[model samples]
Target: MALWIEAESVERRSNATEDDLQAIIRAVYRQVLGNAHVLDSQRLTNVESQFRNGDITVRNFVRAVAQSDLYRSRCFETSSPYRFIELNFKHLLGRAPQDQAEIAEHVQIYHQYGYEAEINSYIDSDEYIRSFGEHLVPSARGNRTQSGIKNVSFNRSFTLMRGFAANDVGKSAKLISDIGGNLPTKIVAPSGASGVYSNTGKRFRVAVSQVSYGPRVTQSVTTFEVGYSQLSQKIQNIQKTGGKILRVTEVA
Candidate 1:
């Protein structure tokens, strides 16, 4: 994060010297005090020490020192008395002030005061969530042939899905589409050899539809409707073949 302050002008005062600095300080003091002004030599000395220590520049220090209530009466007598002395310097000069390190330091100070909200607004613009799939049924066979059984249910299964921020929709969709075909598969039902069924001739085959992607919906969408339709069709076919659909007592 970065911060900055804009002073009106600077180049016109390029030749400013120590005398100019003293004049500005005196002006600030006079502005604060009126007819019975008393100069505080001790405080002035401390200000000079701060400047020598590089804690404050001559320009900034003079203004801050002048802002005391004593000086305010003389310098800024109006209701909208300008407390910012930097602006005054800019007005006296012609162009904006130049201080690279000062700007950087000011920016750092602003960040210290917790201005990260502004920083993040310019950086992150998306959010996302992860999803997992589950198995619905296990493989099994009936004693008598049925008309509508096609696929076997599995003991366990899983799938993956993504929920993306609105701004990330384009990229998210592309990525989902690219890896959609390679997603992990769940065994709805195991082969008869796995002891899922006793009859070797009663093995079931698994099939998956193309991965579907779309904006989130409040209720079920056309995709789910279509999937249900296909499942119903398969059930009908298995029932016609004399295979019975197994009914479970409870769902895990």
Candidate 2:
């Protein structure tokens, strides 16, 4: 399976030409918009003009694109909260959420601070600065090794990325069940076939850190082994009962 799409990094040069500026603009749209083709009507004319005139750096241009109404309409408004945040990590940070904490953090930011703040959290992050700096555009980094990232995130990134040919308009959060339950993401081939990634016949162990029984709150941890078909319902039940999920692992 091809885990990563190979693309040359497009960076801004000190003495940039007309062609250079165009390429940078295209790269910005391609990376920030999840490979979606930008229509002339959909283009952020003012932001593009600012970038063309060297008024804003690539980082700011990316910020502008992410926070644009077009992006909000396509990615945020139409997508579930989880799917929106997943795309943010893929498009801006060039990776998937490391764990549930990362996902919860972004979720909290979006709920408490608003959309622009959620986008800014990633663009202003140290990880973003270290990864792409100010001139280079953000792209999928699952192909390369990243410091402090877990091995499972590589598979999760591919799950979100799909490919360079694919756009970010997907509605469902692919890794939501796995990440929310702390399961390792399986890498499936992009052919959309049922194979190793299918959990049809698997069994999983769900660990809940806390669960409320009746009107009483119990802090004791509980574990439940369930089949794949029952996993979703079980997780839902856990959540409904005010349970904190610690992990969900496949049991052999």
Candidate 3:
């Protein structure tokens, strides 16, 4: 699971609806690609349809965005190594570079393996595999910054700590384009003593938390578990809802 501020905000939502899927697609356009116009493109529409139909996961949707021609022109083409690498961290991993060295490390990859390889590195990293598996989306949390906040895993409410919110013009714009904040889904490991997991399926079992937002003035966001197997559905829920997940376990 991926989130902007805290890790606890992410979860595996089995009850995600068509509206939630649409909202999620919008979230991807604004947050991952940073171009609202891309939402109108047939490519994105196709990807959305595939994801909604379960032909793809949020992780696959994310991969499509990064590998899309739109992302190449907007993010990679003609950009400095530093700028490109930094954007990759934001778009692919959903966070900024941990430090100059991290940037340098990625830069070296870009130089040696070409742009595509650089992109794959982030998606293929252990962090991606462990936190998100292949069915979740990535969101920004100051995972690498010296000013990063301590990660709050799945259990209790998580507040977006400082340093994770991007300060740059484009970065801030992307956050604004979606819903002016992060989503309520996350991919995290199980919590406490191994929690529960079906002895079937080849993927990880994640604990999911449901999220909702209200009144920007109040900065009101709330999350809870309506039940173990399902969550509250707002129906075509155009509201912002996503977070970091915790206590995930690999099943069968």
Report lDDT (CA) for all predictions. 0.27, 0.83, 0.50
What's the lDDT for residue 72 in model 1? 40
Native-to-model Cα distance after best TM-score fit, residue 9 in candidate 2, in Å: 1.1
Model 2 Cα shift for residue 41 (angstroms): 1.2
lDDT of 2 by residue, 1-252 (tens): 554675678899899998999999999989888888889999988989999999999999999999999889888998878779899998898888988789879989999999999999999999999999999998888767888788888888887776676677556566767887877887756455422234556788998988446787567888899886666667767876778888888798
RMSD of 1: 32.5
Q: What's the TM for model 2?
A: 0.82
Ranking according to TM-score, highest score first? 2, 3, 1
Q: Estimate TM-scores for all models.
A: 0.20, 0.82, 0.52
Error of 2 at 93 (Å): 0.8
Candidate number of the best lDDT: 2
User: What would the per-residue lDDT of candidate 3 be over residues 1-252, giving only the tens digit for each residue?
Assistant: 233244333433679877777777766665566433553544577877788888887777887888888888777764544456666766666554433346557767988988778888988888777657776667654544323322322210111112233222231111111111123323334335533322112333344344445554233323332221221122112222444333333344
The best-first sequence of candidates by lDDT reads 2, 3, 1
TM-score winner among the candidates?
Answer: 2
Candidate 3 segments exceeding 4 Å error: 1-12, 35-39, 143-252
Looking at candidate 3, what is the lDDT of residue 132?
A: 70
Candidate 1 clashes: the total is 34
Per-residue lDDT of model 1, residues 33-128, tens digit only: 221345564246667556445566534443444444533443334311111121221112211112223223433543564333322221121210
